[model samples]
Target: MMIKPLLLAGALSIGLLSGCATDANRVPEITYEAAANSPFVATNYRAADALISQFRASPDGGPLIVATVVNIDALDQSSTLGRLISEQVSARFSQRGWAMVEMKFRSAVYMKRGEGELILTREIGEVARLNKAQAVILGSYGVSGTVVFINMKIVQPGSNIVVAAYDYVLPYNNEIRSMLVRSTR
Candidate 1:
C-alpha cells in the first residue's frame, strides 16, 4: 500500500512540474510597427518640404526634379535603401509640382559603371541642362549605429552650386530598415 501511494505521488509531482515548465517558459511575442507611419519617413518628408520651401524662395527654383537619392551605406548609391528613398522623395517632390526625370538617363550620367556609385564629375550640369531642369534635388543618407543622417540639396545645374540644403537625423530601427528594403504597398 505504501509503495502504491509513493508511486502515485511521484507521478503527480512529475505532471505538476511539466505543467509549470510549459507556463514558465513561453516564447516572447513581438509585433513590429509599420514602415510608412515610421518616424524616420516622417522626419525625412518634413526635411524635404523644408528644403523645397527654401528652393522655391531661391532665384533658380522653377521646373525642378529629384535627380537622385543615394545611400552612402558602403558607398553604394543603387542599393534598395537608396532606390526606396529616391522613389518616395521623388513622389513627394512631384506632389509639390517638381518634375520627375527619367531614371535611366539620370543613372547613366551619375551612376558609375560597375561600381554603382554616384560620381558627379563637373558634367552634372551638362546632364541637367540636357534634361531641361533648372535645378535638381540630390539626397543622401548614412547610417551609424541606431541613427541615420539624411542630407538633401537643390543644386543649380550649370554652376553646380547648392541653392538650398537641409539635413536631419532620424532614430533608426527595424521598421526603418523594412521601409528602406520593402516597396510601398
Candidate 2:
C-alpha cells in the first residue's frame, strides 16, 4: 500500500512539472524595457492609421505640414517627446504616400531655442499659406497619473476646421519621463 501511494504522488508531481514547462514555452517573457521601447513606433503608426481612416480630403488636395507637438498647458513650448512624436507621426503619414512638407526647411513657422517648429492657433493660416499647405498636423500632450494623453488633429488651413483627429495614451515610464524633460539651455 505504501509503495502504491508513493508511485501515485510521483506521477502527479511529474505531471505538474510538465504542465508548468508547457505554459512557460507558450508564454514569452516580456521585460519592461522591451515593452517601453516597442510602443513608441507602434503607437505612432496606429495614430497615423487612425487619422487616415477619418480623412476625407484628397491626397492631391495639397501638401500636409506637420508641426512640432506642444504641451497643452503651454502652446509655445515643446519637449523632446513632442518633437519626436511629430517626426514619427509625420513619417508614418509620408510612408502611406501623403505629401508631407518638411517644416524645418521652411522659415514661415516660428521656432524657439531648443524647441522645434511651433505653429500657434492664430498663425496656422499664415504658416499654411506660406507653405501652401492644404492641411496642418497639430498635436498636444498632457500628463495625468501614470499615463500621457495625446491629441492630434489635421486642420484645413483656410477654414481652421479639423478634417481628422485622433486621441491616444502612452505609459508614463522612465523613457517617456526623460523625453518630457525640457533642456534649460
> TM-scores across all candidates?
0.65, 0.78
Off by over 4 Å in 2: 1-37, 183-185
Worst 10 residues of 1 by lDDT: 112-121
Q: For this target, which candidate reaches the highest lDDT against the unseen true structure? A: 2
Per-residue CA lDDT of candidate 1, range 105-180, in tens?
Answer: 5544655543232435366677667667787777778878898787888888788888899988766776567645
> Would you list the C-alpha lDDT of every candidate in the order shown?
0.66, 0.88
Lowest lDDT block of 10, candidate 2: 176-185
Candidate 1 clashes: the total is: 0
Q: List the residue pairs that clash in candidate 1.
A: none
User: For candidate 2, lDDT tens digit of each residue in 61-119?
Assistant: 87899988888888878898999999999999999888998978777667777788888
lDDT for 108 in candidate 2 is: 66
Off by over 4 Å in 1: 1-36, 57-62, 71-78, 105-119, 177-185
Clashes of each: 0, 0
Report how far off residue 136 is in candidate 2 (Å).
0.3
